[model samples]
Target chain A: MKKLFLPFLIILLLTSCRHRLVPMIGMDSNGDEVIEHVSAVNFKSSSADVMNLVAKDTLTTLSNHKFNSGWDMNHFQVGLLINTTVGPLAWKVSATPGFRLVFKKVKK
Target chain B: MKSIILIISLITSATLFASSTLPTDWYQPSFDKGANQNTLSTPSAQADEEIDHLFSTQHKTLKRLNKNANKKWKVTDYVFMLALSKSGLLGFKALNGKSVFQVYYQKKKATPVKVEESKPIDIFVHEDMTDSDLQAQIEPVLGALVATKKIDRNTTLSGDIVERINSVKQVVGNLEASTDKKFYLSAFRIDLGINSSGILLPSWAAHKGTEVVLRLQWTRIVKKGAPKALAYKSKVNSNFQAFTESVLKDLNKIDESPLASTGKKAVKVRIGMGVTTTDAIIISSAKTTFMGNLIFKRNKKYKPSKSVVTNDYQYVIDKSIDGAKKMGQISNERFIKGLNKAVKMGGYFVRKADNSKKWKVSMLRAWYILSVQGFMGLAPITATSEIELFYK
Candidate 1:
């Protein structure tokens, strides 16, 4: 039982804490590249900080007419993974401003 | 830090109270507790049924026809299609002040069946797929056709074929000719698949309960002598396969994520992002992707001009920032690292009819991924300033 402990611990570490590369892109808006709105949600019962990274800049810019704006988009479509989190502190810690936004284009 | 926490709590409480009158489940949160409320997941029951029907019917039939050599082979035309449902609403993400992703599907046309045209055709289901592996699964379709006397063993087969591999097919190398007929094998063994738009995100698969189809079309072949036929018919468009533009990056650009180098046409880029409501289990946001043609343009000078150049790509707000690197400059540095000489010449992502225009350097890629979480669990967030630039 003692010998198996080391081996099992190593195996668990190997499988559980592996890093994954998600196919993410720069969702850089054309204008207003600042943190238009930012809020942090902490669940007292669960003890997790879910920082809301809300940049509601794209909505006002897109053409409202469906045909011209993006005739192609007609649904809410995004990829989902079972056991993956976004960042280093994703779903784990309650750090201040889980992410720091430095918008080079936006004037402070 | 205390101020930040207090501010967050204050805002959250106020927002909760504002929507207090609504039902608790109205804006349900928490991934484990409920089904994903995103656009892709809501009508999933209908999506699942439609997808199953397609697989059971059209896909099965295509596999069957690829087998039984006795059955007449129509000219192969494969199409890839993505459709978006007019939902009750695109949940919170689509409805909020955020743009969404677009899904493109290959158009389905009424196939013209030539009843008296007894010309037998042998569909070479791309050189990559093995006959034995697929034969058994779709055998029933052919068996039913033959049993009903739709086609017989003695029917003359037209050796004429159409390969529906996605890339632009060009017959490059050797040719072996029979006394009456001639056969020419294409040079590159192009392997590709269906995609999320042009982005090969995953295997362009249909979720368990939704419908997305990759279809192959067979065209009527006009047999004009061997030499003339070989001269005119170089390659046919095989629109959609199981893999796509991004998967090609699987073996080579193993480090590159979100983008798979699926097709070998030219150096192209697919930019996308996602947003969700309650569950991360189900995709609650559209993979809003856009294909930008960088390398392969009929007009060479106009290609990848702005997307790769740093100066031309600055957004209006870009200059005011103290130390902001231009999106183009970032894209240039990262993309140049992965791009080889070939994509420098070939890979170009363009619209079906508008491959002539010069590529633009815009901050927003038409679709915006907006992630907003309220009412359950730790709320959601959305950010996309880091793009994984992939090349082949």
Candidate 2:
């Protein structure tokens, strides 16, 4: 009975759900388990603004061997100096659209 | 006396040119940037909150109008459909005008699924909206919410208005049926986008970003109404299964993107990396630098000066930390995560259906994307969006 208890505890710990701070995922790549840490940022703008940015030319094609063979790199971004008026407040802005971009690994 | 006049004119001309700090062709529209209003002024979180307020407020107004259970004017029966799509163009059009969406006005057939007890909403549509016009619209929404103290002035409305509309309907539906209440007002919204497919797997190539996201509630209790619209305005027309096949078959025959307006012009570029604090920054830099290499490879005009690939590039930093300091670091870190998921969204759907294992896509993965707030937003150029690839 004591031996059975030890195995149950091990299995419980391995399969338990835990709180995630960065909200990331781990996957299998080329038969090896790969845990790539993706950024945890999100765009705080509206649907109109996002599509306008992407539809406009923000997509770039990248080639790299480090990426899995099945995927290609495409960077989608809207780096604008937004004159945002939040609630009753006024507007200030940013340059470089900063780091808010959608980097996708698409297939050829 | 004539010389004096000439000197005065010269002084005026010099003053006008003095403040022109930017280069001669700075404002010229290009692929990188633009001087358009859509490029300059963007909507805020406050603007989105107003979308919710408008629906809720319109619902309330609608309820008052629908008091007569037996009356034809009562909104007990309506016909509509959610116009959400995976195509950026179709999705954009869906929100551009009410015409693109399925509409059934006074006496159409629709079933309000479920509902909760809450006040209804008011709806409004504008022909041409300017920046200030949006602010003017938000004024009343904020005013009422703050007045009732339901929310504060500084609140950020990050909630999906589309999903909320459904929840409100579900709750109101349930409440009205169970408690014999009269919460007869409901609202619906659609926000959508086509996830970015890199230069290789362009959405134009595969009919990937096309689908249905329909929901309409004509009544808490079923009723009848006349047709408000003659036909579905969806571009891809999911009603026809052959739509995707014909579109893809035609697209496959093309050598370039269907829309020549995309400005497929590519130039030579090299990417240089800068250092930063977080390990994520280093990882992100590597990804970005690789992207730079991609641009060089994709462009026809770019020529390699040396075999080692050292020259002709754009310099990328670890983060724009020096720009605004903390914000730069925080923003870049978040971008890394978003990029990761975007890749997943892009590759997952396409890969799942791989029949020969040469990277075919599957139906289940494709559905995951369509079902998932599910993704990407902006503008008094109004649109419907789903937030995805995000963190808590």
Candidate 3:
């Protein structure tokens, strides 16, 4: 029972491991999930300021049909996928305003 | 600075740990009603919303595209014509404007009919058409309006009915032999005009305007009713003929020409009959030929100076008959005679005969082609025919 428990714990830890972060920045015209913009960006850290700014710009341009002095950011599914085949490193995030960043978190 | 760095690192670690366990609750203003709370959904509702937004945003662009398509349809409005014949017929295009599409129909399919768009079409049934057959041919086109309904089916033709259509007789082409040339009498001249008219007159107050003129060059073969064959001694000579001219002289001036010397200066208009050559086969075998041209002119304007118009028109008639066949049956012969008779008959309705001029009967050069079928003894047969006209 102890050995079975250890294997289950390992599986859970592996599934929960942090791999990458992506920042998506664009919005649907009606505040829908559909992303509408010229392009988007990807990032490893949610804290990446550049990713957020680009995402915001993309959303602002798409919804309002004009670029904003400040960045416009809206959250959308974009093309996000999390399943059995793809590892965490395969995760991608994208933003518009002409920027994309792909990075994997340093595994602890 | 050290404390601040440690604080940021701790915050990052905690955030990562949270994300690894569960993704962020993505901001969706559209879901304020808790519409998509439990499941991570790429909702179909979201796709519809995006499409609706696009339509609303580019509303003007799509509207213009629709308008352009409609305008294109207007130019080609006359996609079909319901009634047609050698003389004329009424055509209605459900989509056309006020313009009458004048399409010229050929007896043979080889001839091209001219279609005039944007002109008020003059609808006419040849005078020879029996009231019954005319109705049959026209009923389907007119939505059976003539027969099925109680509405007035009266139609005033463009020119006087050239001739009542005789289903028994076929119209002919006789630009060839002199006698065969004289059949087409001068129909009314059509002066094509652009939109609208010059006057609005009450039906009661009558007035006269300067006469609009027309000319015809045709040939006629003198036949005692209908000829059976191309024989030289065919009863053609028994028909009395007149080659008349209508000269519209000033009602107030003294007559100048020899026709006026007889104390009548009114322009002389007369209809005559004569003959020229028959078909080549007939001419080769017989002692005589069967043809003549019936020249119809505005006698008042006939002069030597305007001969250029004469030359050009003669050229047109000559070129028109290069490959036409020679002989046909009585149907073609009668039509030519009927057309000539209609001119004389219809002209009397418009003006009085001026009894004051010396008249001359002469023939002109032209050709003929046989056309149409004559119904005889319950069988329809083609007739020998000719077409002729006068220039100047």
Instruction: Give the residue spans of candidate 3 off by over 4 A.
Output: A1-108, B1-131, B141-392
Q: Model 2 TM-score?
A: 0.17
User: What is candidate 2's lDDT per residue for B1-392, written digit by digit as tens?
Assistant: 00000000000001111221112111111222222212122223443332233223222222332223222211221111111111111111111112211111121222222211111332221212233554564456545645654343443321232332333232222211111111111211212211221111211212224231112222332112323232223322221112212221221222222112322211111111212222121211222111100101122332333332112211122222112222222222222222233323323212211222221111111111101111111101111111111100
| Tens-digit lDDT string for candidate 1 (B1-392) | 00000000000111211211122222223223233322111224443333333222323222322122212212122211111111111111111122211111111222332111111222223323333533542244344434655344222211111222221222211122111211111112211222222222222121212122222211222222434333322321111111111222221322222223423222223322211121111112222111111111111232121332122111111111112332111222222222332122112111111121221111111111112221111111232211112222
DockQ, computed on Cα atoms, for candidate 2: 0.01
> DockQ, in order, for the candidates?
0.01, 0.01, 0.01
The TM-scores, one per candidate, come to 0.17, 0.17, 0.16
TM-score of chain A of each: 0.20, 0.21, 0.22
TM-score, candidate 3, is 0.16
Local distance difference test values of all predictions, in order? 0.21, 0.22, 0.22
lDDT of each residue in A1-108, candidate 3, tens digit only: 998999999887775443211211111223222111211122223213333343344434444543243432221211111111123343233222222111222234
Cα lDDT for residue A24, candidate 2: 12
In candidate 1, stretches whose alpha carbon ends up further than 4 angstroms from where it belongs are: A1-5, A17-108, B1-102, B106-342, B345-392
